[model samples]
Target: MNFLNVDIPVKNVPELDKGFVPLGLFFKNYQKGAAKPLCIAVERSGGQIGTYETKIYGTPEMEQADAYYVDRLVKFLLWSWGGFKVSICGDDNVAAAIRAAYSEGGSRAFDKGFMEQVYETEFIVESLPYDKKPEAVQRAESIGRHLDGGRIGFDAGGSDRKVSAVLDGEPIYSEEVVWFPKTISNPDYHFEGIMAALSTAAAKILEKGGHVDAIGVSSAGVYIDNKCMVASLFLKVGKDEFDKKVKNIYTRAAEQLSSQLGYHIPVVVANDGDVSALAGAMGLGENGIMGIAMGTSEAVGYVDTEGNICGWLNELAFAPVDGQPDAMEDEWSGDIGCGVKYFSQDGVIKLAPRAGIELTGASPAEKLKEVQALMAADDARAKAVYESIGVYLGHTLGLYAMFYDIRHVQMMGRVMSGKGGDIIMETASRVMDEEYPDVAFRPEAPDEKTRRVGQSAAAASLPELK
Candidate 1:
């Protein structure tokens, strides 16, 4: 049984005149003691192909020791296709480990930055038990569309829910309502809260004589085929009830709202992080953008050059960014040195008391707010928390570059509010310029109105309503 088999389509092949090449890697599981050699198949988009294989002499664990085989595979791909942009499809753990190796850099086979040139790579993992290929979906056309009448868009965050009435890509009315999805066990509470918010937004638009045309939603967690697979919002709901009812809660709510309104309005749902990236692209009018929302946890999304959302898990919160032996552990996932520990509100709150700045609030969010308020007053301890975050961002940007074709990074969320955000961005910029000058991209935080309204507007653009 070959461990790897890849096939590249002909249309993606780059011509000699083109500046870069596109490559694909299909990585299968590593069998413990299989005698079958590891194999890689490469072909021109024109159908010409050849097989490359190497024998494995040890257990799968031994083969993965120090990521030896992973390093060889990456080098082989780069050698086979020079200056190529690669997409990897494989097991989640293996892909995570390999990607971490590229940035964490402890391999002896290559120099520390040997893989820097081929940094714009993406990893797609099989989501299901029997999935043979990575997930890819054709994105809806044109994130910006003119709705002659009106549309309702909702962005559900961990702490609050934002609803807006949008027309012609501009939001006319918007409101943010606080809700406790994480702590509330009853799904009915969440359902009722969402419907109430949407109802309020829709009524405002209708009062202005503009009929509702469609509905769009942006939410946290893994959404596959418009169904919530794993989400923190449903954490309190039992597995049996969640799987049976809460999984497709968005669609159900949309249907109920449409029936109540006495019209069939099309509803489209997307990941909140993806919506954030779309919003950033719309705000900046640029492509190849990545959006990071450092709020309750680190949420991430990316938009490719063609402005299409890649349908992979872009859940960078759990993705490892630090490879040091003594990295900090994420209390939720128990994973060491993930993006969550460095780029989240929790990260700030965690460091606040440690920095000797006493927090007056009970919850993490409140504690973070207290620290931010202190930073506004030029408190040294609070300032240090943000400065450390800046350093973290600067170093992690280099690691993120290895996976994303990042040209513009838009930073948002509660953690990036007010004076604290400025400190973080300024320090991060200095770090990038001084330490990793080779990295060409810079991080920017959009204005408050743009960050808030633009996200809901982007949510409005998720569906293709004919």
Candidate 2:
């Protein structure tokens, strides 16, 4: 398939999404041209800066393509690495377009607003000369793996809430409670539910003759200092009530529980992505790992070569994947060809009808269950859906290689459940071997059964009690 000037020898293509072009393959072929220098830098909290300096096509005929290419790169960098101020050095036209798009009433208003809320700062776009460009901080701080004393680990999800009462490194009690947090608008529902979960876990810890030392929360969304900046669990909540109550709900719940327990219990809330990475790292005893969970959406995090988790957003759900101009659009971010549309249960639901499977489930998760049932029946159509995702992953890893120094890739979530997941991992490995010979997803996928901690339970190691 020819995308722009480059031709990609893609073997396994999605039947429905035939126009799919892997961004990694496309970029790899593009950079082999008369690429010019361009630097994209982003500054986040604590003035931490992350820079991606690369070559862009400088040919006069490729002006429009240059803009599209640069824009996607910046978008990927922002969501994956994260930043409030985007500094574009050595490109004026591309910078101008970004400034206009990120403006108050532009195409990327949603992304800009989300960043502002996350970093709690006004977002800015600046175009600078290469000489005046920022340098890479690449700050990967040591986090998680405290695993001491009495702790309550809570994982907040859109469908259910999971809490584990962990004493030392082992969990004394664990439970999963189903609730509809995404549909509820009242902050009290959230407050009461969180309190109930914490209270239940506390009772179990007390039964084990332990007292709450720390409360650690593993959750989705961008968190700044254990505060809810933006989360899907609070999607229905209004800004007024979110600020008034939901902002500090986790800590407040911990505080109230502490008041009852008669002890000062500090709570550390880390993004589930980071916790997943930490879990995978601990499980494998390796670093330079990137964790990707295909659940309701695509969640990702990285553990750098130094065995440290970076402070970046690692929100790959919104990061672009397919280079197809008319690729599938994500409902939340309203972005096309993103990971959420290709790597999550939504990807399965999108492919089901095309693969001749009629799904009648009301929710995305339930629809995924239907597909898994078909896969278990050795349905060829179900296999086709997973093969397409495998093709998507095999190519996207090349794109990810452009940024991260990856040694091992850890996969998780409901989308990766059952035999279908095996199809994805196996097919992806084959694609890597055939197409990206050098891009290695080494040591194979880690065994989930032997994992040190479940994705949510990993939060028990987040806080180091004082």
Candidate 3:
């Protein structure tokens, strides 16, 4: 299929979605001939900057095509390597397009508002000079994996909370408790639950003649320096309450616990996606690992080659993968063929009908279960859905490789739970081998029984002791 008057080549097509065209492969061929150079850079918190140099079709007649290509690229780069202020060096028309699209009431309005909340600044896009293009400055910290003395590890989930007490890199006690953080508007419920979980874990450690030294949290959201920036866990919490009680909830909880314990317990909270990558890196005993968790939506984290978590926004859910205007649109982003639709439960549900499986009127989670159950029974339709996902992933990884220096990729979350998971892995590996053989890095999956060591040991290792 053509991408707005541009021909896109495809070596592998998803079993269910024939219109799938990976951005990575498209870029490789898109910049072939008569393309003009374009430089784009984005500046985020702490003056961190990410820059990309791309080429667009150069002609008055192809201005629309240039805008289309640049718009998607800027959006992808913004979500992949986040920034609130964007600088474009090249064509004015495309730069104006980027500015308008990321502004109020534009196509990326949700992204703009979210980034503004995350960075606490107005989102801006302007023109830049080619020779004066800013260099990339990333914030990558070697956090986590402390595993010394008494440590508390907490993973806050929408449906449940998990806590673990680790001593010298070994978990002494761990438990998962069910709760609803997303449905309840009362931040008190969340606060109480968080406190109870922390207290329970601390008690477990104290019973073993240990005390809390450092606490690390892994939760669904964006966090900077252990402060909650933006998250779905507080979706129902009122704006005023969230600003007053929730932004620093993790830090506040630790302070209260410190008062009761009669000693300061350092706490560090990282996005769950980053913690997942930390888990994968620690599991593989290597760096440059990207962890992709496919649950209700796609959550991604990256560990650079130096074994540090890059502070760039890895919220790849909104990032494009399919490059098809007609592909499935994300419910939240209203963008077509993004990663959230291709990599999450939405991807599974989208393919079921095409595979001749009817999951009418079922909850999304229940629909995933129905398909997984069918997979267990060796249903061909279910296999088709997974194979399609596999195809999507293999090429998508090719796109991911363009941005990340990935050495290993850890796939986790509920979507990767059943035999279908195996099919996805095998099929994706095959596609990667055939289509992206020269590309660096290989995808690896941890065992199903104990994938990434329950994330406790990893989260427990976040903060360094003084």
Candidate 4:
């Protein structure tokens, strides 16, 4: 793999310093009978230019998959560089392959509407002409004064929802209530449950003579323009009701709560992964952080170098991580070798039986609990489960590095809860040091208090709060 740095001129570009960076991503399969790698050229304001190239090698089908992966990597890079308005330049074949992959709806489907949402630009099959009209750039919502006065932060998880009453970046009150979001088919159940939780938090603020100014939400699934495009929370609802009622559930719930409270507050909802990344960034006081939560599923969020969350679909759970022909299959997507199978609690449960440990529990969660108990007692079989996960982490981190200039990865979720978490991080670090020494990055896990505070505080900061 060869990486060359070159300066390329972009024509008729608006001044980037006006809050948006312009980037051109080029993909070429063969150049002079040799496979040309994925190339990205970025131009910021003040006459600055940077180019990045990474080699690609595989058969036609594999290379096509690589293109999809490269597309995701380019999005991450451009986001980290700063807010970007990107132009994708590639030949007819590259463009068609990407379009087909996204259309097929599998591991390659995550980037389906990515270009339209994040970059506000389209993919050009032919060579990009020097002069093209740039689309009107929309600046991200400002977080200014959102975190100040009083705020309610909520994080909706698989089994429980967490609510926090925050005053100027500090939580005055917080609580967790268990709710059945997945199995409930009625949208009213979800609506009532969510509003009740927020009401509890709002009451705390009012008790202290503080008025609720805004509500920030972090939830699992895809959110576009503050609406739930696809989420597990509404999976059981009928298609018609899911589309009509459950789509904007959060915003609607907020409005109802606002009416009851006799004041209208701005409401902001974002992907949980992005909130986790934002939390990690806030906790560390740094940028370029990718936060991966390995709980019921693998959730990912990234904070770019400019300390802004890129609105890209960081749905890395379904993103392909292993290219081997016989990788483990995701039961949900039936795709081979996805990130979810290796990063979530499901990953550990799947590996339990393989390690020759027979779990007598009835469910996967119960089986996971048994494994954690074994690890607590220093059982070798339980230890091996995490060690293998460490190995997975090392390899996946290498793969992730190809796409993200990740400086720090904050590992959260149930899988990283106990002694098992320590072993996983230790072994992964050793693997990276011994096997992938060239990769310059480190992984860290936050303490319990820090994790909770960071999560709620970051949730409060989502509307771009100062």
Model 3 residue 315 lDDT score: 92
Which consecutive 10 residues in model 1 have the weakest lDDT in total? 12-21
Candidate 3 per-residue C-alpha lDDT over 193-250 given as tens digits, one digit per residue, 9 for 90 to 100: 9999999999989999987899999999988877888898999999899999999899
Candidate 3: Cα lDDT at 154: 95
Model 2 ranges with Cα > 4 A deviation:
7-12, 442-452
List, residue by residue over 1-466, the lDDT tens digit for candidate 1: 1222222222211111121111111121232333534333322222223333433433454554324344445444433322212333333444455555444433311312322312223322112122233232233234533344578888888888988898766688888888889998888888898889888888888888877788888999767567876788777998788877778888888888788889888887778888898888877778888899999889888887778765545767765554434566776644465678778987797677667887789788888889988998999888888887887787667656755678999898889998999988998788777656788998898756456557777787676667
Worst 10 residues of 3 by lDDT: 447-456
Flag the better candidate by lDDT, 1 or 4. Answer: 4
lDDT of 1: 0.65
Which residue pairs of candidate 4 clash? 143-463, 143-464, 143-465
Note the Cα lDDT for every prediction shown. Answer: 0.65, 0.84, 0.86, 0.67
For candidate 1, the TM-score is: 0.72
- Per-residue lDDT for 1-466 in model 2, tens only? 8766666677756556788888887777777774579889999988789888788776777877787778888889899877789999988888999999898888788789889988888999999987899987765788777888988889888789988899988988888999999999999998898889899999998988988888889888888889988898899999999999989988899899989988789998888888888888878778888888899888888889898878888998999989888888887777788999889998999898999999999878789999999999999999999988887887777778888889888888888889988988887887788878888673245576426477656788788876
Task: Look at candidate 4 and tell me the lDDT of residue 367.
Answer: 84
Please provide TM-scores, in order, for all candidate models, with all chains considered together: 0.72, 0.96, 0.97, 0.78
TM-score result, candidate 3: 0.97
How are the candidates ranked when ordered by TM-score, highest leading? 3, 2, 4, 1
Clashes (backbone N, CA, C under 3 Å), per candidate, total 1, 0, 4, 3
The most accurate candidate by lDDT is 3
